[model samples]
Target: MSDELDLLRAADPAPAGEGPWRDRPLDARAERGLNRLLHSRRTRRAGRRLMLRAEAAVLALFAVLAFTFSDAGSSPAVAAPVALVVHDAAPPLSLDALARSAEARARTAGAADGPHRGSHLQSWYMSMESGPDAAPPVTVPEERITRWNADGSGSELVVATDPRHPGRPVIHDDHGRWRTVSDGKVLHRKSYPAGSAAQHGGLTARTKPPTDPEALRAHLAQLYGGADGTSTTPQLLLALSSFRQEWTPGPRETAAIVRMLADADGLRPAGTVIDRLGRRGQAYVYDDPDGPDGASDATRQMVILDPRSGQLLGLEITFTKDQPDFKITAGEVMSYEAWLP
Candidate 1:
């Protein structure tokens, strides 16, 4: 029992090259949270052997989780960290013009009357298996839905099912350890807390996004930029993750964001492709480096968009180099997500 837990003693995610969100450190408070998560009763339950490994695997994953996702005692187990993908070189297209087209379509449609409509986010997120040095990886196909009420309350529900089994979702027991159950109808859920960031970065009513491109750029820079106060590719990626993650955006805002992305560094047109939801979208590739050494652990992040309607279709990420310690092969998808239409 102590031997299996030795893996939990890891202070940093092994193979520094593999942990993606390397921007921050795990502080003492976060460490205590991990301790609680590891020592929970469910880790020793009879049927949760696989679940125990998963909880440890997730610890390996979040060791480098940014402070934004980690609270003192309560840890957010539901964060998809930085990601990228590696694929064929693409011919550059007039992404700016495409963004303009989408924006015009949004203006024509006008503002939606109520909260963003109910939409489901689906993805194959990478999950790790705790091992000797680095953890072995598995693809967790997850389904997510976030909804806002007319009275301004909302909830996010996430159901992760093993692709091999398909219906059983990986869940956490009352003791806060991961468990897999046979019920297809059961799901894990959480609600949006007041004053915290909204899923996909929706600003409050007082801070609704300006539809103009320049203004949108400033907004993102202020919201997602780094220490030097400049917006980088990674910050923009986080901005995209926080604000537009599968939730429907206003057409003008969508158009503006698309234009902003078109001009952002490292975006290359990957041409039109089908998303996991089977929707056709134009793809853009962003290879972001995580460490000071140029190109070390650089990930290829593919963001799919429906240019015609100007909606973001989904995002996928993959490692670009060999992570031998973790047994991670080059080009293996780290995570993938699509919105159900």
Candidate 2:
């Protein structure tokens, strides 16, 4: 049994190269060849791994570019500008130049024509003051210019009062042509009627109503004190009715008002201030003269803002006397309407 086991062990081939197959222990040259084969296999595997990584990187870059381009393509197209056609013979003026010319025209015409000839009407109402021991406050009904018209040259502006009086219409014929007549008496008479048109140069027209209510209101407020204050409510209503009839505010007027307000310096001070209604962004609180006394009144102006653009909307003025002895008498809202040229 021992001889059989020894023969079987000897027949096992002497562990790869020890017997007949190798005839000797593996030499250094053979060992080197074997090592080279192993190295080649490892290098080939590493190369395959590197190639996979490179392919993945390239794929990732392409995916990023695809996403970017797709997103860009999905964006909306920009809107094109609309064309405007002018019928008058005058050359088209740039917005800025037109505004300057319009202002100059308004000033010159206002001076020549005298006060506006709109019907002067008013109504009275009573309300309580804010103080603990205060008397009832007097409030005049809302006064508005119902109708207004400008001569072809814009030299004469004829305005009919809301509460038109029983007499003849007020005429402001300052620029000749009987620009305006009130009860046979020419409220405004033009010295050089024929030549006055030349002073206005070319007549630029408005295309739409003014959108900025704030500036319009402020302008109207400034002009408020200059007009006649005595008239009936019905008459004033009539004047307001005329505003829609005679003058249609244009988009250019609105744009002009917005620009004016934006250009106004120091409209709001550095520090935060509460408005008359104690709300943020409601009113701009400022200082102004207080009637006869040297004392000053805190003037709070409520501004109407455009909801979409967050722009100044309109303005309301309220005067409160800081002096302990004096009472506040003026607190009114001034509204503005854009008149088309």
Candidate 3:
């Protein structure tokens, strides 16, 4: 029993005493909701399997219970949904304006033209696996750094850490055991020899990207590898993200990327916001309701750029609707990547 409790502690996503509601007792409505959830057909089936794995079962139960009673503490439901307030008063910056400014900044900075050889980034991404034995869906946060030397050798390092919550236990799955570890725990580290670093499917790694805005747009689509007859917005965003993973864009390349995005259809300026790395950036968004040509998922994609230099800052994808089978909720972030300058 002691060992079991320790495992539960390690797998707890939210440790006790963290949130305002942690100390508050559940209201009557919330208690009733929890009872219904525990006895539901799906819960019973899951509970049978969960009995074999106390940690995963409890983790899944907590996730569902939290969502079920999230609004229980608030006032009773009303006829209409409440409207959210936007505090920022400044108007959203237009894509065209951002493109022009980025180009000007690139030229003024006289940055080298082309992709840089490395990147340092922090990321949080949802990992979901489905099966009788699969663990619950989880979002993992970590920091990754990759560097390449002039001799073509490079190294990669990944650490489990969330900068926003320093010293907090970082959750990770080791084999089938969901556990927590101290921040900065080294998850992976490796060094590569010359010629090995260039082995990637990235567009920029294959060929030099043109600075011409129209040409770059076409280049992105040509290399996107999406099915024909589908919207390129989703594919382009993925390709752009892959580009960031392989290489950081230089000033000239940054300017071209901005200009190319400016002309892409369906993307609109989405006001400024602070990225996960604490840098303020201009945001642009594209919503894909039916997903790519044949896909059925609905998701929102966003690209954040440094407002001053127009360099790419971050990329995010989020689900806009609930997926009950997968234990996903609306407005849940699917993935986020913040590239450092």
lDDT scores in order: 0.53, 0.28, 0.60
- Model 1 scores worst on lDDT over the 10 consecutive residues at 67-76
Model 3 lDDT, residue 52, Cα: 47
Q: Candidate 3's residue-wise lDDT over 237-300, tens digit each?
A: 6656655665777777888888878877789887888776778888888888964222465878
Tens digits of per-residue lDDT for model 2, 1-341: 23222222222212232212312222111221122222112222336675455435433433222111110111111111111111223342232343454444444443233322222222111112234443322221222222223443233322332122425343221211112234334223223343343232111112122334344433322221110233222122222222222233333343444344334332332222222222232122223343111224443432333322222322333444343322334443222222222
Tens-place lDDT per residue, model 1, 1-341, is: 43233334332223334333543333222332344334333423465777667676857655566222211222223333334322345553457878878767766774462226345666565544323643234343556676766555677786654333445444332222234445344356767655433332223212556677778666544332220124356446554553444245666777877887877777888777766555777888877766111225567778788858667788776778876655676777766767654
Q: For each candidate, give its TM-score against the true structure.
A: 0.62, 0.26, 0.68
Best by lDDT: 3
> Using alpha carbons, what is the TM-score of model 1?
0.62
lDDT of residue 126 for candidate 2: 19
Name the Cα RMSD for model 1.
Answer: 13.4
Clashing pairs in 3: none
Model 3 residue runs over 4 Å out of place are 1-88, 109-114, 130-135, 194-206, 222-224, 227-230, 292-294
